[model samples]
Target chain A: MLDQKAHKPHERLAAHLKDDLSQVDEMIRARMASEHAPRIPEVTAHLVDAGGKRLRPMLTLASARLCGYEGGHHIHLATAVEFIHTATLLHDDVVDESGQRRGRPTANLLWDNKSSVLVGDYLFARSFQLMTEADSLRVLQVLSNASATITEGEVLQLTAAQDLGTTEDTYFKVVRGKTAALFAAATEVGGILAGVSEDRIKALHDYGDALGIAFQVVDDLLDFWGGDATGKNIGDDFRERKLTLPIIKAIARGDDEERAFWKRTLEKNDQRDGDLERALEIMTAHGALDDTRAAALDWAARAKACLDALPEDPIRDMLSDIADYVVARLN
Target chain B: MLDQKAHKPHERLAAHLKDDLSQVDEMIRARMASEHAPRIPEVTAHLVDAGGKRLRPMLTLASARLCGYEGGHHIHLATAVEFIHTATLLHDDVVDESGQRRGRPTANLLWDNKSSVLVGDYLFARSFQLMTEADSLRVLQVLSNASATITEGEVLQLTAAQDLGTTEDTYFKVVRGKTAALFAAATEVGGILAGVSEDRIKALHDYGDALGIAFQVVDDLLDFWGGDATGKNIGDDFRERKLTLPIIKAIARGDDEERAFWKRTLEKNDQRDGDLERALEIMTAHGALDDTRAAALDWAARAKACLDALPEDPIRDMLSDIADYVVARLN
Candidate 1:
């Protein structure tokens, strides 16, 4: 895994897809600008320039290229993907009451919550406009469904955030809604834009879905085990009383006394000193972290397998490698 | 204008379009449901069942009906319009930190800000899904642009909320962005769905724009002069330091002393005992209320004029009458 870190799968993909990625970036910059509302560009520029991995849009581009798409609509779809991602990030920060994103202050923190909420909405609409310009009904259907699923996932998470009774089924549903849906759509739209076969489209969808799930699982795992490099505070999810996969797994195996601890810290949000440490100890004792890591690896493997249906190309290989990279960080 | 109140233009329109409107309502109910997220239906039903006038969606139905649209997609478009309107209300209540809507507890207050924000986003995405299902590229373009305009208007209003420097031009821009953008789109999409002439589409767009502007102006006026029936507390905008049409008019004609008062009350958010009453006094002295009322009536007249391009029909007549009805309450 340490050796894998030096490979930088995303960097390799970005290098191979540099032209399309640059066009996507340019489209993003141009579309985010508003003639009447100057604040929109300002707010959007802050988040857009914050040095994110741009993985979702890159996935769209890579999938398009792999499907032998020579047309220009892929760039619009890629840009729309990025816009959707950025818009969700803006609203997610507000909903999560977050202060930082990608090692910088959040839009909600820099601007007001009102600005974050409204601008997120503006971006969502702008994304729709971009996709419409692509003139693909199938692409529009995929992206719109993804948007709805993403919001539904977030809302489901709201209801399930701190409930100790949340099941693995609900967790997967939430993950699919919040993370996998957009990823799935991002890739599926790429195949649709390429006018690829239905089988290839479904393969791309499955790849993105599994990759996103692995990505989110690793993210939740990092909340307990990763460092400041993640741009999120270690254990922030625990403090916020979010019942992500790690805790949800731990709660399943806990005894009555341990269950009460979760009830106090998560459901009731009544925390004391050393609660995070105690919770980590409980998860370690129950092998929840190890199980969660295993689950991520399984998803990553599934993601890589989905890429097998696509044609053999450098971009396809890189897409496969990125799935490995998503889970590799956990190792 | 006073005589127009007796006609009950909206009720007549509703009665005429009852079948379509009911179908739209049914579609809305069907689309708002989430299998995994029951909270979505619960929160949406609260606002949807609040006895709102259904004015925006009714406009879509009426416009489509008047244009001889025999297709069924109008139900989808109309529902999309209502979902957009309701989603905005959910987020607006959160942005305004309001406690009540339609004489009941707001979604934010009843559930939470998180629910309100997330559910609003869900509804927004759902609306897009509904419009996409309607299968009109033109409809998608109009609605997406309108969505962006709605958000941009809200963001601009956020930036301009309490500022004394907000001009009538800016007010109109904000009004168009927030309220009228959806209105314009609702009517334009109806015409587009009907496959009407471009000239007729423009007429519908203009009609909705003026009607929306008039509607908002009257609502703003009601915030000051109207009684309890408007479902908003009198001087709520004044207390919140909002720069609506009346305040913008008063500020334009205000003298230095009045300017100082505005700066202290609005910009600085420093209030003394009797600020709302004094603000009303200043607006009265400047004849700001009268001018504002005149502007609303002018927009209403302009709205009615745009309907002349459409063929003679009961729906078209009702639409024209509704334009008159929007500002008639001011009498």
Candidate 2:
């Protein structure tokens, strides 16, 4: 029953933003087309058509409207947010050597890494093009800074992937870069385009940042014990040796033998039979899963608190509910 | 002797822009550094320090200065141009699976494809960030559009690389996308920053466009017949199955036997020991090499003619001489 509730808020939010969401969708379709390079549209279509929730762009639109943005540039900014998100997904799949994303074959898997990488670059350039069309220098600065942060987060992730010495602070920095930066930008730009007060803009950014962290934390926790509703095989992160929050927490408290097990399984990438079960057991022994869930819930609560700066409206209520729903999966 | 003279004009232009070029270099060095991700500078420094001519950025500087504009923002725009160029080279090396660039092991070969793709992305984002710092909406539009065109050009080049039906017109389209788009943007933005007349802006764009076409055509010609002074082995393009202007021309005029040869060597990517030599023989037989050289000269002439819109000045004289030097490699 709780799991069923998790899907309701985003759907309702999408419906609330239906007209603007549709505009964003149309903008995405029009912008993704390539007049000369057919492969760009083909590769982009495969991912765009894959049933992503379009949650990020929806957040941008909702934030803009919540702050009383009347102009049409919100659509452009929303579409730009989606493009940045999609471009990162394309490159992330290649970097991870992933085969499936959103329960479909990845762009890199279907076409090639070269196409995925180049097309990702194209979408990023297109995102810049879209952002400029918004006619706001401040918006450009925020999004460009977010883009740099995202890339820095990715490079940090690559270097920090299998190392056992990765600290919790470093983990948060990586998450902030890879996941939360764009979310913050997505919402912050919405407030910016509306010419909202600086305090309100900061509040929107904090909301998106906390929501993104909570989302990623829950996603990581689900990787170990989450059911199929997460659309990922349990323990996938363990198998890949990614040092997520739970694993890092577990390793910090792990005994010598447990550390050796982690080194063998993750650092060395020599995963064996029963490794997944052992990882789960060790994580449980250290209470890592519960702590990670608690952390996600705390972030979700923080995200909800940031909405107090905004005027009461249906869109604002939806954002608050979306935060609650992000951590509800932990139940 | 002529080839040696070809290298002198660029050096002279660099000298002319020494103060601005030094500032641009400092900006590049500063922007490329990353506090979180150390690997970014490592990969970027490998290419940035590889002694590239910095011709694109120089055009930006020269155009602005020649238009009698005095502003500090030209350095930012010029640096942005170089960042765009470097980012493309990094991704291009990955897409081409090149082991060497600028006579050293490429970033992809030295590190891995993952680093190359991600860092290329970092630079693109950095370029966007740099463009925004210049304080001009029109500058943002020109550079963003150029960024999109550059990526599209790369994607077009990917799809069109080995196909035999790639015509002269298609080759120009691909070249324009891959090479001229940025060049045109670089010079166009310079004029815009100077707030020059519309005619001068168009002239700057046309000059960059024709100069880039001439540069690429001559580079393609040199790929087939260049001596060691060009720092490449002749026939490398043929060995790689690239359909440059000469190969496209030869394919267009070839008889049935020659068409079959192209089909086997290019489309099929099947090559024997004598294939490069034989390919050269066929191109000669069809006079494709001569025609390609003539085309390069014509573009160079067009590039020179565009400069008539600018005032008579030393910078204009240097630009005209650079065009002549581009095609001098054919001699």
Candidate 3:
């Protein structure tokens, strides 16, 4: 994990999404600045300019292009999907009472919770408008379905917080609803708008869903085990009392004493200094991190395999590479 | 202002939206309950079962039916629109820090703000899912645009809360975004789904817009002149420091001293008992209330007039009667 090597993973990933990523970026900049409600430009620009990896929109763009979508509406569909994703993130911070995001002060922290909520809402609405421009009922259907899944996912996560009994089944449901649903929809609509066959659409959807699951799984894993000082904040998930996969695995493997320790720390969200060390010791002793990484790799492999049914193209090749790149950086 | 007379007006309004209203009630009850999240059902039921006049959804249904729509999707569209509106109200009460809604405790009052916000988001998602079932690009456009407008309207209201210089134009814009946009979309979608002529669809849209404007205008007037001990609190608007039409008009007509008094009380959003009385007196002296009433009547007239272009039928006739009834109850 040298500094240069540490950045190699992101660079390699960017190389895969290169062209479609650029298109999604350009479309996002164009669509984010609507003429109505001058405030839209101001509020949207604040977050949009902050620079995201554009990972979700790229999935959509690549998916559609890979499926032979020569039409431009896919651009609109891609950007719309991204906006919906971003809007949810904004409102989520406020609801979670979170103060930081992507290593910066959150929108709620900078202004107030009210602005974050309303602006998040505005962005959501704007995304809908973007989808409307696609002029395909099926495309709208795909995107709105994703939007609903995203919201329901968030609600499940909210209600599930700090509840130790949150099972692996529910965790997957929450992750699918909150994250993978949009990823799948974004790519699925791309194929759909291209008027691709149902099989290809399903293939792209499976690819995106598996990739998203892998992405989130890796994120959860890093929060617990990424050893570099960079992502060493493994204790926040326990501190927040979130029911992540590693913790679920650990709990399932716990003895009576270990179970009591988990209840006192993660379930109660009260951790002492020695708790992280203790938790890490128990996780390694129980092979939790190893199991979690293996699961992420499994999802990533499934994602790559889903692309096998699609027609061959540079875009398809890149999407397969992107799938591998999703969890490649995970130790 | 008596409970007996209040029922007369409410019953008239309710009957106007009767068929559509009942359908919305059934749809709402069915959708809010899901097997996966029992808690979601409980939280949602608290808000949904606590009935407010289902005016917004009824507008969608009545408008669709009035526009001669024959499709089944409109039902889902109407209900989806309503779920979104309810979700916003749940969030709004939390933001506004209000305690009462429809003569009962607000959602935020009953539960914590956290529950209100998260549950509100869940309903928003459910609404999106319902509308996506319509599978119409045009329908998605109308609904998504309305969603964005609603958010922008709310934010405008938030920023403009106590600004004494709030213009009639801004007020109208806010009201349109907040209320009329959805109303217009509700009816407009009916014509779109019915495969009607574009001009007829536009006419339906205009009809809904005028009716919604009139509805909101009358609402503001009632807030000022309607007495307490019945019909909810009259001075709540004044107390909240909201700059509604009557006050905005009165401010325009004020002398220098009167202007300063507004700056202190209205802008400050703090007023003694005398201040409300004095503000009412000033508004009356300048005929602002009458001016507002006249404007509302004009809108109602325009709304009824839009029906002339519609095909002659009993439904159309009832719609015309409904428009008249919206403002007639004010008198």
Candidate 4:
């Protein structure tokens, strides 16, 4: 079954960069340990061991290798990327009050909100320490800026959560900050560490940015797609009163009755039974899901097109395949 | 009144570094502003404008100036230090469930925990961006390590809260992490950016660490000293079940009855009307407050002594005065 999964683009990239990935893992384990705070490791181990796809770090590894870089700093960079992702997830769980993540009880749920917040902070510091070791001022700038962007996006999402007036522009801005910023930084720093040209580096950034936007759109669509495919309960977004792309589109095209339903369920958060079903119906009636899927496909195509600027290599092809794979679920 | 306040050592340092301090303020206001997320600045302004003395940034500026260094990077470093301090305060309020800080309602209270957490994260990222602009990898390493230490200390404090078994060693470790790490980093990074000798940098680190320990010990002592001098209600730490030095000392020396009282009040968190009085009486009987005061003075003296290694500048004198002023309240 594991070998069969290897046919996936990200998995193929992982197979190609097996040694570097292991080194990244080793560095993550080594750095996450704290002599004073045993709780830090216990909380982090629960999250890291749950085995998310490690998609962000894999992007960094693939990008660097695709540019023909042969040095250990890429490992540090990759590990740093993963650490940032983990840190954000830990904090996000607390912010979202999420009970489960990656199919396991979240750190916030298992330990407490205090542990999640502080441990998330610790991971962020660790990520910076790793990035500093890579000795690239430019990489530090990119990652730190991305960090700021991610947090800003999260804050925007929080403020926009139940507002029926949330625009698609605001939705895109939030997605760019919370998701694409890190993804773009992850790949851009790889090209940067490899001493690639400005054009190629920009191309890598564009690819990652588009891929991340696509990934998040697909995720939001999956939340309303009514399936067990994403390992999440369908309508979780509606239950949480989140303002994602589909809901935003539906609101834009909604009738007065539909608008009243959204205001009662989302804006006012007086959700009743069958509210999720009603939301899905309204979204489908407005063709919001179809438009959202079209947006995801558009981003995926843009991501694949950006890869054309990179040198022809197996890693590049895998990256292109990864872009396609991100939206493949929608098909 | 302002001039009278200026006689305070930290105020004296601020007066001395007026130009640079203004520049730090300017940088802080500039960087804290988010183009997309208006809430980020709104939450940050509530905390930043509350005006908590800005001691950490003053340390960074004082260290650099005392080294006779001529550079603009110190402003960035000082701003970064302030940002880091602000970030921690935001997160700390959430973890402590604090309603007020610096005699003002905390950001977490004014907004929410989610806002505080995400905005705190934004400030941290902003701090890193500021640090990278200073362009010294060694400085980054010291500051990032301090960041890790600070978070670890906070987590340890959380795990150790209300536990009767928390040792003095554990107490010191927690204090070192949550308080001294940032202090040490703030000062050490100044020296590092100034291109000072390793020996002088070590001295700066020691000065900041000792000063921070003294500051925290004094704050904790003020909590039980039964006065409004600290702008906090007496026995707040007791109500929160925080095992500070005085309580840790009292617990170690308590008789069976006293031990049971502590276990019931602290460990079990069962308290009645006279519990605070009883707790204070037990601490007084055991000379815990006296001993804790002595500990603060000792650390203050050590902080002052570390400054002797630097050149005899007015800034150095101000630094020594700051150390002495930290513990002078105990008298």
Candidate 5:
């Protein structure tokens, strides 16, 4: 369904989550307005107005609804989570000195690092404000823990950027910190806000966590293979020396010469025209891509398994579909 | 009492906030630990281990306790607030390209902007976690609002740097954003946690806001007239072309030639040897320093007045003394 691509993945999610998404957007626009600085809106609009999957917030809404949350606060919490996500992006652009995000000039590149950094801070503050509105201590704890995890993920990515020896364990930790923690927090907070049972909450948390990991794995996969839809270069991850699952698997299967090539490119960041193609060939021959696809599918299955414990509802069905959608990206 | 050699203002507040201070320290240490990235711990330790005033956390603790809070989470909330403060400092040093803070090498200078930015993100995440521990959406709202205010204040300061026309109104707005908002949040969260009446909560917030304004104004005044014990260079504000209350007031009093001279030194940043002295002369001649001190004292009085409506306790006395202490640095 996501592959039909007459509409975008995020747009599809937004359509299913239309009412919830509209509510979230209005809330975000209202909150982003600041009496103190005019420049704040300018910087925030660059990212907030930019089209994103809204995957994080949707995970939040879907999780809460699946758990039978009837309260209105979950929307606020979802927006809060999205704000944190956007704030991190602003800072990430500044730190990475990236020229593009989703094929657009990053706020840092368009404005300046100083604006990016400070405005990112502003959004973070706004997020905290939104999260604070929930009034639930458990919700606060879940979201905050997710935030810390996200930062740890970013820090891990920072040093892992050029390092070749970065193991799969470290990469997993990074994925958990950067991507999955928020997913866990977003969904976990949903259950907490709903005041659902701990067992079901755990199930939802696992679902979100697994889905986040699976989604990120696919994202890494697409960073190397997403030429048509995402416009990502095949060697994007290679250029960054990202040390994704496929690369790690490829190295495990490599001979000494192949290993040396991997070492020179990843460690030294030395690249040639054919290096990306060579790496892809090695990965294909070693079945690394197959393994990665399998792993993503496994996570998708795990996310679905989490629903076995949640209430049977329309929201639950969509969540299961989302799990499948995450894996389908690799196909 | 504030001017006495043995009884410093901070010392009084420290004594008043002894219990809360210990709690804040414990919380800070506990939160700064990270399992995955050892670098996070190392970088966080550089600042958390460094003995600063613990003033921000103290504000949080005191604000809560003074409002009749008997719970434990205020300590966590206070630490979260302080972490936000420290994270901003880490980022600020990078943007300012500053070297020393409180006589220690800044994180950016000691490590790098990469580490600084990433670690700052880590702390920010950690803080969100801590605030969430408070579990009150109201507490989160106060803390987040303060965080946004702080960011706005910092940005305003950045953009306003070297712009000599930045008015007293703008100066206060900037200081309010950067410094007072956190103080108000610290206090406001305290009231929220205590379940105190909204009126008293507003009072605590006002107390914090006015006290913070007073404290920062005193800080600006001390930067020009304060001795070595003040720990900042006299006229350092002028050298940096920072538009402080003194400079803002001085510009209002300057004639055409003086305005041109002030512009050259401040707006153009073409200062020479004795320019600081001339700037100080302008500040003194127009009673800018005197006016700033008077304004600070007025705010301190207002801060103290806010407490009059509260129950009588040593902490209350201590809070008032803290206000007096902010303006006492000139002694």
Candidate 6:
């Protein structure tokens, strides 16, 4: 087993890529500024400088380094990925009416929804401009297509919310759209910029996709797992009526009474004081939480396996550890 | 003089490029479809089919045709431009909390702000994808830069709204961002796709920029010009407290009393019934309205002058006539 007391995978990766990460920070700061509208920078800086781990951009940097890339465009792609992420966070907070994000007041709350909306748009446009500067049509295609998928996923999540008919298939689609698309694109573009072979690029894409899925599944799991150290409260997703994986699994295996319970709590948004405990009891009784945990582990394993196709570099090892580290919170 | 009864310039352009326009329509319908999210197409179709003149896309088509070039990619660029416009309209309604657009209930009003915001994002991403299909880095740069400028302008407008300190320079920047950036990009990309020379491209760019400026100036003027055939009501800008061209001019020319009225009406947004009339009277008394009209005419003339650089074709004549038609309402 790895030394858990040692530096975390992302921290080690950040150390190794210290220069590149700093360059990315520089690029993000430079690009987010607006000559005409100071609000663009204000709203963007609030989110971009929020203490969230720069995991996505790190993935790009790590992937490019692992693929033997020595060029600077990876920095551009990494900054672009972060910009897209920041933009989406701004918009998502508005959509979810979220007051806080990354333990800070969201841009939507700090400013108004209008600032969040318009500033999100500005960042998106900025991202588009940055990606085009990469000057690779393939890179443009990968990023642009991922962007479409991400937005499509958000829309699907919106429509699928509070609907008990949301299948596991639809759940995966939403997860892919909301989380995995950019992750995959982030890694895939790194490989592309490195002039790596198609197979290697595919492997990187698969690795990022699996890693993202595992990351989100753990996130959803932790939301209900309660009392974990992730700073998320128990049953927050439940309060929001989000139809996540465990609930979807529970709904599928639920007895008539259990299904009715879900319907009342989720579909109808009618929850009594004891409903959270009862819902957890039902989920545990049906092994739904266990199954969700298993699915997350499987994805994490798949992510690690995809890394084997890359060269045996320290970066690759860190990437594998990152996958494990994502699901390790469950332990 | 041409027979005004025969057809509007846009109508003539539309008739001339009916096949291209229809192809653009087909592409828009096809591309706007979301395999998972039906709401995307539903919201998109509502705006796309709202029977507003497809003026921007037609500019793209006419520019390409006038450049003596033939290609299918122009259709893609045109559709991409339209998608950008539609996406902006969606977000604008949400930002403005508007209930109506193009004489139809807005997507934000019909569905919700969430739908409008997410669907608009989806359309923006879709536009990004379509523009990449044109397979030119330069095209990507142009469209992406325009997208950035457009969003920047919007954020500026959001911040600049109701501020009496907004200058003519700031007003033009806002106008470029909100309206003219896409217009210039649309026409510029047509010449780009035609593989035209640098001077021709510059001419196309200038023509589009001036035309867009004129188009928006006329739009702003009409919002307060009060009673023409256009469906817009007078003083909409005043009611919204938006700082448009005429108001900027009027504010610059206003004395201390006039400034107080504007500060009360626009800055503080406190108004009784006659405030709109008083605002108009102040504007007319200062010749702000007339100067605004003259400015619009200057831009229209500039747009027509730019057309002189391109080869003489039926489309060229139509474009010049279109410029004239844009400001013809002032007569």
Name the candidate that leads on lDDT: 4
- Candidates sorted by DockQ, best first: 4, 6, 2, 1, 5, 3
Query: Model 3: per-residue lDDT, tens digit, B1-331?
Result: 1224333443554565566567777888888775555566677787677766666666666657766777677778778877887888887875676787767788766765656766777777677778778777777778878888888788788778788778999899989988888878878887887778888888889988998999888888888878442245877788888888999999999999889889989777557769888988999999999999999999989998988888886567767777787787676
TM-score of chain B of each: 0.93, 0.93, 0.91, 0.95, 0.91, 0.94
Each candidate's DockQ: 0.66, 0.69, 0.49, 0.77, 0.57, 0.74
Residue A174 displacement in candidate 2 (angstroms): 0.7
> Between 2 and 3, whose TM-score is larger?
2
For residues B1-331, write the lDDT of model 2, one tens digit per residue. 1233345777778878889999999999999998899989998999999958999999999999999989899999999999999999888867777322333344345347778888998998998899899989889988888888888888888788789988888889889989999999999999999999999999999999999999999888998877575787999888777789999999989889999999999888889999999998999988999999999999999999999999888889889999998898777
lDDT per residue, candidate 6, A11-85, as tens digits? 888888889999999999999999888888888888887757899999999999999999889999999999999
Give Cα-based local distance difference scores for all models.
0.89, 0.89, 0.77, 0.91, 0.80, 0.89
Worst 10 residues of 6 chain B by lDDT: B98-107
TM-score-wise, the better of 3 and 6 is 6
lDDT for each residue of candidate 4 in B187-259, tens digit (9 for 90 to 100): 9988888888889999999999999999999999999995577889999999989999999999999999999
Q: What is the lDDT of residue A239 in candidate 2?
A: 81
lDDT of 3 by residue, A1-331 (tens): 1234434444444565566567777877776664445666677777787767777777777777777778888778778887888788777767667422323344345346677677777777777788778877677667766776666677787778778798999999888988899889988988898888899899989988998899888888888777453344756776777888998999999999999999889666577889988988998899999999999999999998998889988667767776777787674
TM-score of chain A of each: 0.97, 0.97, 0.88, 0.98, 0.94, 0.97
Off by over 4 Å in 3: A1-23, A34-36, A98-111, A227-232, B1-23, B227-232, B329-331
State the weakest 10-residue window (summed lDDT) of model 2 chain A: A1-10
Predicted candidate 1 versus true structure: per-residue lDDT over A1-331, tens digit per residue: 1223345989888887877888888899999998778899999999999859899999899888999999999899989989989989988887777888999999877777777878888999999999899998889989989988998888888888778889888999999999999999999998998888999999999999999999998998999987565888888999988888889889999899999999999988899999999999999999999999999999999999998899999888889889988888976
Candidate 5 CAPRI level: medium
DockQ of 2: 0.69
The TM-scores, one per candidate, come to 0.95, 0.96, 0.90, 0.96, 0.89, 0.96
Query: Each candidate: RMSD to true structure?
Result: 3.6, 3.5, 4.5, 2.9, 4.0, 3.1
What are the clashing pairs of model 5?
A: A132-B137, A135-B137, A137-B135, A140-B132
Better of 1 and 6 by DockQ: 6
Q: Is candidate 3 or candidate 5 better by DockQ?
A: 5
Model 5: how far is A330 from its true place, Å?
3.0
- In Å, residue B270's CA in model 2 sits off its true spot by 1.9
